[model samples]
Target: MAAGLEARGRTATQVRLRRRFLRFVRVRPGERVLEVGCGTGVVVRDLVGLVGRRGEVVGVDASRLMLGKARTLCRESARRTRLTLRVADGARLPFAAGRFDAALAITVILHVIDPMLVVREMARVTRPGGRVGLQDQDFGVVAVTHPERELTDRILHGVAAHIYPEPHSGRRLPGLLRAAGLEGVRLQTDVFQDTTLEPWTKTFLERRGERAVRFGIVDAATARRWLDGFTHLVAQGAFVLTINYYGAVGTKSR
Candidate 1:
């Protein structure tokens, strides 16, 4: 999981989208920021650079193992900026109210049991007029090319629905911020596109294929055939996959 996070973070388009979200949230030098569910510290590493030497970035996740990996991964970058890692749940952040200039959860809301609770916690930790940001991929918007369109749709949609309570979580981000009592909400939409079957995308599809079989969405032989379809597309230089990522920011009322 850590390796996959690192790989996705290194992808060219991903880096751009992450930085763009930070900019949208107005993460400036010297501002204190918090990242909820900071898995592998990928976004935290980027936050450190954006916040600069005077600023600090605090990352919190529920998984101790993930935090351990994050610590090791962020060691070098920590020298340039203040970085803190804590084992804490997103729905119940371990911080004082009005502590941060901004709080963000990227690609995290979809997995939570109660996304609104998490967003409300994020708003509570941020100071009045500070920004709360969220970014997530809407599985409903995903598009992938394959000769077996029906099979691809069944696997992709079925796996996502089984894994996430809200497969279309991305589109609800803005409304979440508003419902959390944040004002002046704004949204930014971005896409993750893969045409050559990059390593990260390959792993993504492989995981889906595995889950499809496990969840009884498809049989073993069918899953194998479905995955092989992607390989063939890649070989033919006709592979295409795109997932929409929605980023939203809102200000805490003063």
Candidate 2:
């Protein structure tokens, strides 16, 4: 996993988002759940708790670094016994058919090159009538609080295009789920609107900004420019960054 992603594992928003996403999942005790792209086991820890002693939570990620981190976290959890972590790819899950009651891929579908394959894989692993849930943010729906909307959009798109070649995957999730032969697909959106930019600015500058530098994605100059623009927007007191995250759940055919 990228160092930036490791850093993201420790962010407050990331933690909160993971918890909220789990709540959205409504995992019950004694149920088997697979969490795709379970980076750093942040969500996996929550899943373990939700599943209780009788249930099991299997977490899979393609990144060895992330799996290492997840293993460390899992080891520290008291509920570790109920959790399992694997280094696997979402596009090709290494599980037998109908192995899980439900599956969730939080903020991971966007990274997949062939999202349909992932959807099919998740459906294949889940039992009939089982639910498969996917959650991701749409860049087009993201509300920027920065003063320079144009610049922010430009930077965001530029970086996203480079980091994630297919940034449009999130937009196609609903259709992909339908195409995967899942039924009763339902899509819902959640918005996190904050008037103060301090949290987000700090999140970006401290974590994302540093990651950009570490990964050589953006130079110090560009990072500084982005931060400066964000600071100015925060000072204006009219800053409100609204994140539009959508979640869709479908049941495999019986």
Candidate 3:
């Protein structure tokens, strides 16, 4: 599995976006929240604050490396006492029925083999009348200002398939939610734009490009070309990349 996008400085953006995403769900204090694939605990920290000190936040991921980072981040937070980090698969969550008030699976289903199974598990673990939420980017909706949009999409999607199967999984979220037997399932979309390309290019190269090269997905030269193209697009004020993230929330029937 590929290392999560959350690295040292990159967490700030994720934290900000997650806060906004969670706002849609109206997360409350003192709730038992389960975060599936809580990479590096960035979302976990945000959830801890939202749920307050009286709440419990349990973060689960299949990657121990991610869990290690999450554990470390949890320990450094003010609500550390309210947090728990564990390693578990989304398809088979290791918890009793109706164990949580809410469950969130962020940017993780696309990487899993069977997103429906994960959604079922999320619904199963959530208590009656509780919420089960999922957030994921629609790869088909990703738009870039580059001239080679098709090529870029192909390469990017190819990389995703190699690194994480089912890269464009958000398109199926609604159907999956229904299959999971949840009620009142709703889907909302959000867009994020980069104001400047320099920072975006630098961050992408440093984080994603480096990982691509390390994983032998792309050669260093190819990575450099990708960065250069991004830089050019940014210089022309045409460096616009929009990702339509689909978020679904539903209630578990009693």
Candidate 4:
């Protein structure tokens, strides 16, 4: 999970989406920005360069281990800009109201039991005129090459429903942001189509394949066949996977 988190932001599709999101927020030099669930700080490294030395970029996560990893990975960027790392919960941020020019929680709310609390906190901490941007993946829409159609659907749906706490958060982000009283809400999507193995597809089968039985999605051996089929396709240079990531932008009412 840690390696995936660190490598995901460096992907071509992710870089494109990050640039678009920075434009969406109208990120300015020296403005304070906050990223919740910062993980290995891939976003932080980008935001730091955008914000420059005068600006502040704070990343908060629930895991000390993640923060430590982020501190290491983001070290150069941190030196180039004002960067801070904190261990904090998504639902309960440790900052005063309107403390940031922009607040972001990417691929985060899905893990929160009370995603509203996190959204509300994001809105509350972002000053009026500041923007709140959120991006998440809806794994329910994952498309992959598999020999068995039924088995493929089962694995995808099972991971989304069982592994992720809020598998539908991508679709629900707009409503959740609006409910938090953020205005001018807009949603955009970027689909990642990969012919090569990357972080997005890394360990995808290993993480959820054997669990076909555990998730009650399919029989055990049947799952193995589906996994093996991917290997066959990869060897033949025919592997492909498409997943959509949704991004929402909103302005905090002044």
Candidate 5:
């Protein structure tokens, strides 16, 4: 998981999209920030740069292993910027209320059992007028160029349904922030497009394929066939994959 997080963070598209969302949240130097579910400190590293030397960025994750990896990955950056990592739950952040200028969770709401609780905790830790940002991919609109459309739908849709309570979580961010009593909610939509089947993209597909088989959505043979379809398309220079990411930000009410 650490390797995957690092790989995704290193991807050009991901880096651009992440930093764009941070800017949308209006992160500034010398402000304290908190990131929930900071897997491998990918976004935390970016936040360190955005907050500058005078600012502090605190990261929390439920998994100690991921936090350990984050510390290792973010070691050098911590020297120049105030950075902290802790193993904590999103629904019960270990900080006092109004402790941060901004709080964000990227691609994390979808996996959590209770997103609202987490959002509320994030809001509690953020000062009134500070921003709460949430970003996630809406799997409902993901498009891929594959000859086996039916098979693709079965694997992708079935796996997502089995894994997440809300597969279309990205589109719900604005509503979520509002439900959490945040004001002036705004949304930003971004696309991750891959035409050449980059390594990260391949791993993404492979992981999906693995999940499909484990979930009994497709047999092992069928899963292999489905993945091979992508390779064939890539060889023919016809491969295309696009996923939409939705970023929503809102302010805490005073």
Candidate 6:
């Protein structure tokens, strides 16, 4: 989590997610872009390359710590690509209306206090006919290979969603765009399925189960067993997992 979350680097899974997100947005060269809650600026670095030299991309986040990391990761290219890193709240972006040709909140909505206000702000800050995009996972759709299917279900739908606010954000994105008065809303999904039990995909169970124990959703002993089950399943070469992420984009009314 630390490596991918703070390093402005993509995990193998996130690399695939990024491709799907960019496909939905279809940004053009020389277009000004805004990415709210830009994390550590992994996507911002991509946007910098997408918009090329003439254009600029602003990456803003509510966390100064994240912005600081983003600034450091993007420093080499920021000067050439005209990237800007700032601390700003998504619900109230610090930019004038219609200031950008495109705006996006990639994997950021679920963590926001008000996804609705953030989307509205995204729409408001983009120019007429400009683009708006969002990408998030529906943790509700998680599946893991385990003998206790019922426990797995609880861990995914109840525990994971409990720990992460708006874990089902991916499912709500299309309606959100429409509610914001954006037109021609489009959506695409990227499914993450793995057999190797990568930490990013598999250890999520341990983390969720541990928190579930703390929250009393599951007992500490049960959480331990679940984590232990992961190792056993992997050793037997029977481990498999899947999660779905949705990418959505729309055009602001001209």
Cα lDDT, all candidates: 0.94, 0.76, 0.77, 0.86, 0.94, 0.84
Q: Can you tell me which runs of candidate 2 are displaced by over 4 Å? A: 1-17, 78-81, 198-201, 205-223
List the candidate 3 regions with Cα displacement exceeding 4 Å: 1-4, 7-16, 78-81, 198-201, 205-223
**Candidate 4 lDDT tens digits, 149-239:** 7768878787678877888788888999999999999998878778876756657666678666787787878777787888888889988
Candidate 4 local distance difference test against the native: 0.86
Q: Which residue window of length 10 is worst by lDDT in model 2?
A: 198-207
* Residue 252 lDDT (model 1): 96
lDDT of 5 by residue, 123-198 (tens): 9999999999999999898899999999998888888899887789999999999999999999999999999999
Clashes of each: 0, 0, 0, 0, 0, 0
Of 3 and 6, the candidate ranking higher by lDDT: 6
Tens digit of lDDT per residue, candidate 3, span 79-191? 44477789999889999999999999888888888788889999989999999998887766766676766547655665566666777777778778888998998888777
User: Model 6, range 1-254, lDDT digits (tens) per residue?
Assistant: 43556322445766767866886798888999999988788888889888999998999999898888888888987877778899999999999999999999888888866788999999999999999999887888877888788887776677766666788888999999999999999999888777877756555666788788877888888878877887898899999887888889999998
TM-scores of the models, in the given order?
A: 0.98, 0.85, 0.86, 0.93, 0.98, 0.93
Q: Which clashing pairs does model 3 show?
A: none
lDDT of 2 at 82: 68
How close to the true structure is residue 177 of candidate 4, measured as C-alpha lDDT?
A: 92
CA deviation > 4 Å runs, candidate 4: 213-220
Better of 4 and 6 by lDDT: 4
lDDT (tens digit, per residue) of candidate 2 on 168-251: 565667788899999998877776566666444356544555556666667888777777776777787866777677778888
- Model 3 reaches what TM-score against the true structure? 0.86
Candidate 6, position 125, lDDT: 96
Q: Summarize candidate 1's per-residue lDDT along 131-185 as a digit string, tens digits.
A: 9999999999999999999999999999999999888999999999999999999
Give model 4's TM-score versus the native structure: 0.93
What 10-residue stretch in candidate 4 is worst by lDDT? 197-206
